[model samples]
Each structure stands twice: as structure tokens, then as C-alpha cells.
Target: MDFEEDLANDSEGALLEGTGKVASNLSDREEILQSLDSIHSQINQELNTIGQAIEHVDAEELPNDIEEFSVGLSDYGAELSQFIDEYRHNLSAQSEYFETLSSEEADFADITDGIENVNETHRAMNAHWYELEDTLISMQEILANFEMPTPQEEGE
Candidate 1:
């Protein structure tokens, strides 16, 4: 199945069966990890773009761009909040989705690495920026993936 795609299209409706309106964009445990990684990359890329733009920005141009990006980040943060809300909603179910990692392909490791990227990007953003956008990243969501490995290793 298109595992990664599964997360992106996760249903955003209220979880009548379990938790509150937490964003659980995943039907499987691996999807949780996958979604986290996907977000991690996106956030990192945005941060990098902001950082680079800031460096060469004219003194006069910097403030305006910063404000615009800050607003954009607000929108992004809201989106992530929704995603997490969905995530929590899914996890609220008593039937845990965790299983032997053997179900996942090696490509899934790329998702785990994406989690690390979240940590690194968070750190870099924190060091560089002075606004909430710099540190608004959720580190644990991505870090959680490390415990879930690829299918090959889990089979052993």
C-alpha cells in the first residue's frame, strides 16, 4: 500500500470511538511514524529556507519577510496541531497498532531519519531565530520513530 500517502490523507474527523479531536492522520502505527517524519522534513526545509533568506535579506527587507514568514508559520503550526490532534485521537484507542516491524519495508527507515532531521532543524532554528517559529517544533513525535525499525531488522 501507499503507506506514506496513508498519513497525508488521514481522515480529520472527530474520533467518536476513542479520544477527543486530536489529529491522528494514520490508520497504522507505521503511519504515525511516517507522518511525523514527513512533517519533520517539511519543517526542516522551511526553516532552512527562512534561515538562508534571512542571511542575505537587506536590513530593510528582513523585517517584512520575517513578519510574513511568522504569519505563515502560524498557519503551519495550526495545521500541525490539527495533525497531532488526529494522531492523539487514533492512539486513544485501546487496541494498540504496534506490531513486529517486519511489516515495514526498508524505505521506512528513511522516515525514521526524517525524525532526526526534525531534531536537528529544531536545534538549528532555535539557535538562529528569536521568534516562536524557531522552536515551535515537536521533537518527540519524530523521535518516537526510532523505536520502530524496518521490516528486515524486525524479522530477525
Candidate 2:
């Protein structure tokens, strides 16, 4: 083969190799997308369950309940916020890794879609969390304002 023909064959070979890589990347992207979808669904389901539980709570007044109820909610909110912060940090790292991978592989371009799905899920999670926090704070405030009736006042 002449020099030009040899160079043309080498270029064609490189293109085929790159094509193989792209196909493999596409398969991997599909798997990642499936996993993200599953996670999204699971998060939504769990949040729904939590919402249902909160909705069904029966509030009743009891002796010496104010102090314990306020303290319990404060502690629970702090712990739950810490856990969610850690989870979101991990998710941010995962998104950055996927973004880098997508930039490197042409066939992995769809990875951004999966990442966006995760972002949407995260937003929904945060919304629910914040709503719960607000509700807890409001409950605490309401409890703080209550003055237990003295025996004389109760009798009247």
C-alpha cells in the first residue's frame, strides 16, 4: 500500500475503535439511568409515607406535655437535617462524577438527564423536609404560647 492508503486505513481503524467505546458507554449509561429512576421512585414513596403518617397524628392535651414535645421536635429536626445534609453532599459528588463522565464519552450524553432526575428528586425531598421543619417550628411556637390553666381558673 502507498503511504496515503496506509494513513487512510489507520484513520478508519481508529474510528471503529471509538465507535466500540461509544456503544459500551451507551449500555453503561442505560444501567445508570435505571438505577437513578429506581432511587427517585423510592424517595418519593418514602416521602409520601412520611406525609401520611404526619397527617394522621392525633393531637391531645396531656399534663406536663409541653416541655417534652418541644424538646423532642427540636432534637428530631436537628438529627434529620444532619442526615439529609450528608445525603445531599453525597448526591452532589455523584452528580459531578457523572457530569465528568458525560463530558468524556459522546454516547454518555444522556447521563445529564439522569442527573436532572436526581436533582428534581432532591428538590422535592428538600421541599418536604422544609415544610416539616416549618410545621414543627409552628407547633413549638404554639406550645410556647399556651399557659396551663391554674386550678382556680379551671374551676371557673
Candidate 3:
């Protein structure tokens, strides 16, 4: 059978029947713990299966996966961090504007400026969101195209 089927079968068999009811007393808690233990065992078994499968995978594919992950991370991580910092700064400035606007001495100019600042910050956030989304989509496409080479292919 395929990996997914094997995993599903193993996991399904590990479930404690009627586990949907909430645990109230000590006995129920013990049952829950037992269920958890069963699940953990299944997870460990599946992890071992996965490790064995990885061992059989083409060695070159591993480096490609790492490179893909690293490139995507490097491309987005710094820019996203910087953008978040700028957003935080803008939010802090907006908070100060709100504090000022709450005062009796605050004028209409302050209100307009505050609104403009908030709108600008929102626009920047939306723009950055789209860029991040595009980056994720591109990376997902790369992942979709990637495949573990079969033993036959690896042999060739």
C-alpha cells in the first residue's frame, strides 16, 4: 500500500473509541492519557516509516529541497521582518496621534493627519501581504513540481 494509506490505517487503529466525550474525573483523565499514549506511539511509528522512506529517496533531491526552502526563506524573511518593524513604528505613531486626538486642545489637522497615517499604514500592509502571498504561491508551485525520484529513475 501507499504511504498515506499505511499512515492512515495505523493512525486509525490507534484511536480510543468514544473519545469525544470530555474527561471530568480521574478515571476519564487516565483514559485520555492512555489515548494520548496510543496516538504518540502511532506518530512515532509513522515518523520511523518516514525516516526509512527518506533514506531510500534520491540523495540529490534532499539538497534541492533544502535549497528551495533556504532561497524562499532568504528572499522573504528579512524583508518581512523589516516591514513588520515599520508597521509597528507606524502603529506606535498612530497610537500617539490617537492619544493627542483625545485631548481638548487637539485640532482638525491632527485628525486628518491621523487618518492619513492610518490609511497609509493599511495600504502598506495590504501591499506587503500581496507580495508575501505571491511569494508563497510561487514556492508552493515549486513544491508541487518537485518529486522524489523513483528507484527506477534514480538508477538511470
- TM-score on alpha carbons, each prediction: 0.31, 0.36, 0.49
Write down the RMSD of all candidates, one decimal each: 20.4, 15.5, 19.4
lDDT of 1 by residue, 1-156 (tens): 333433333343122222222224334654754676577567656556555555555445444446465456656655555555544553443122222111234256644664455456546444433343334543334334423223334335
Writing each residue's lDDT as its tens digit, candidate 3 over 111-143 gives 687778778877987798688668757866865
* Candidate 3 segments exceeding 4 Å error: 1-65, 144-156
* Model 2 collision count: 0
Which scores higher on lDDT, 1 or 3?
3
lDDT of model 1 at position 150: 31
Clashes of each: 8, 0, 0
Off by over 4 Å in 2: 1-63, 94-102, 106-108, 143-156
lDDT of 2 by residue, 81-130 (tens): 55455555545554444434434353434555655766786687677668
* Local distance difference test, candidate 1: 0.44
**TM-score between candidate 1 and the true structure:** 0.31
